[model samples]
Target: MCSSVNAELLVDKQTFTSQNFKTFNGNNIKEVNVGWESYGNLNPQKDNVILITHYFTGNSHAAGKYDVADASLGYWDAIIGPGKAIDTNRFFVISVDSLANLGVGDPHVITTGPASINPDTQKPYGLDFPVVTIRDFVNVQKLVLESLGIQKLYAVVGPSMGSMQAIDWAAAYPSKVERMMSVIGAGQSDPWTTALLEHWATPIKLDRNWNDGDYYAGSAPIDGLTASLMLITQNALSADFFNQLGKQTVPFQALESEPLHDIRKSHSIVNWLRSRAQARATTMDANHLLYLVRACQLFITGHQHDFSKAIASITAKTLFLPATQDQLLMPYHAKQTHQALIDSGKKSQIKMLEGPLGHLEGVTGISQHTDAIRAFLKQ
Candidate 1:
């Protein structure tokens, strides 16, 4: 039962342009306006801010309640409340929407990306929008912070894609954040992860309806999107979960009894796959997804191209919490980040949570980590 506040609008809600908005590969410049939401009071000192970044489909809603009045409460309602991990009572939380979000469905969400208004023909930019990087996402965040009169952050936090943004914040503006936590995420995207992500994009690309990503009026690649999500869930879950929950000894008759597509659709594929895919498809811009994937592929921590250097550059008190059973981003990635920070002479903590639920444990069921996050935020 998270509630909403009627505070004066913080961001002016307009388009922004920047010549320095370069792509991850340093290819070209772009303009961006990162949409966001803020909660709690920004004390006169302006140091009591807590930044919350969202995952792939997550938006400005991070806590108590505030996306659409009819929609369910914030995705992390259990952890973000008056006295929960985020503690709205003590900290003002600010969550941001990434560039090229399709959530704001008006005008077809032509954001700065491979799809945006050309400004020349007044038509959809369609591939004209410059590519955006994670660093670019952080830059827009800086703009929002500056505009709102916030000079520093008490902490920056999130899980999954949000975690990447959190890490970038600490690395890019070490002086601004005092603490940073990344859950179920890695400092850099590994090839295995990238390969899987490419698969996710494949269905969309191969579908005839994709139409070179210019399919505005024609049918969308819903089937391909659905199939890709089905694959994603299988890869993301842990063996323990299936062993416990799946039919261990289905009758030979049952195997023959169940319809093929029905069986496929029934394997939590509804809750786990369809829900996530539809959630992502509705809000994420097709081209923006490409931009984000490329940005993830470009993730490096240090020495211009080394992840270790990127990890070493982080000066904020770091906490890397990855689930022990996570298959997508695996626990080893968290351990790797933690070890890198420690080896860099930074006192970072690496604690793993044991869960049968793999990567999803960081989201759908995150109570244990919520407690850990509470303790961290308190400090």
Candidate 2:
């Protein structure tokens, strides 16, 4: 395991604000603040900048400890360091929190989500927050780069939802992105993926305390949120891995007069799942999860429904890394995107990652592909 303490790691959360930010739906917010963090230094040429986009539940903390005594490092700490895959010695790595990320409650992350107070109404935006898309996320990231005096990115690398944003950057601003590494992400959300996303939000919407996303001040929809997260966690890992983790199948039984007796008879796997889900539920806001889910649902490159046309606009050299066991975003999704780019006469390639971690293999299994990633970025 990689140590959480790294002397070279520069950990600090920074903020960027843009006034009159408009969403893809044409709704506008008075202003929006993006939370971000950086590692290494930008060279004088400013061309050594590498942007690392975060996954659905991730934030700007991409590769470091927030403090010396911190128990954990950032999400991609395994592959990013002074001389690791991304090579901080040769490039500046920057990561940013997406709009309405899971970090709504974290003071370190200054993002505009449903949990944020609306400037106009002087209350939480809740369901009133404008609908945001993948393109919208990329657009805001572009502003962050521009503010930092970075005109062109050496590379834009990300996994899952972050990968969607990487593809968007290459398509929307071809001249700005030199290379793109899209890991376990698709050009557009297929019907199956869209349906899954809908299911993820269903439980939250059904919660009585949800009150149509207006439960910020009252009892949060913890039960519904926990159920939703449990669903997500199940898909995030492979069946084989879960089985190896001792997950056993248990028959459902309706509780009679003694409800506690039924709970005592529950399988260990059921209890484990509930424990994990409840832990996540306590940290993340239900409304923020819904917003992020909707954002993922709307993901599309170049805002084009046709995959070929969407990828046709990409001028960056791209590498598609698909996880073979990914139950959520399958390898076929990444393969299809790569095929579309190739058919469009764009430079692209696909590399399949074999692992037991399923969708999370993009992150947990990333170390296995560091050499390939390093070579591609060097090109």
Tell me the whole-model lDDT of each prediction, alpha carbons only: 0.67, 0.86
What TM-score does model 2 achieve against the real structure? Answer: 0.93
Q: For candidate 2, write residues 190-260 as lDDT tens digits.
A: 88999999888999999999999999788989999999998989988998888878734543334433455
Q: Pick the candidate with the highest lDDT.
A: 2
Candidate 1: 10-residue stretch with minimal lDDT: 7-16
Clash number for each model:
7, 0
Q: Which candidate has the top score in TM-score? A: 2
Q: Per-prediction TM-score, please?
A: 0.83, 0.93
The ten-residue window of minimal lDDT in model 2 covers: 250-259
- Cα error, residue 181 of model 2, in Å, equals 0.4
**Candidate 1's error at 379, in angstroms?**
3.0
Task: Estimate candidate 2's alpha-carbon lDDT, on a 0 to 1 scale.
Answer: 0.86
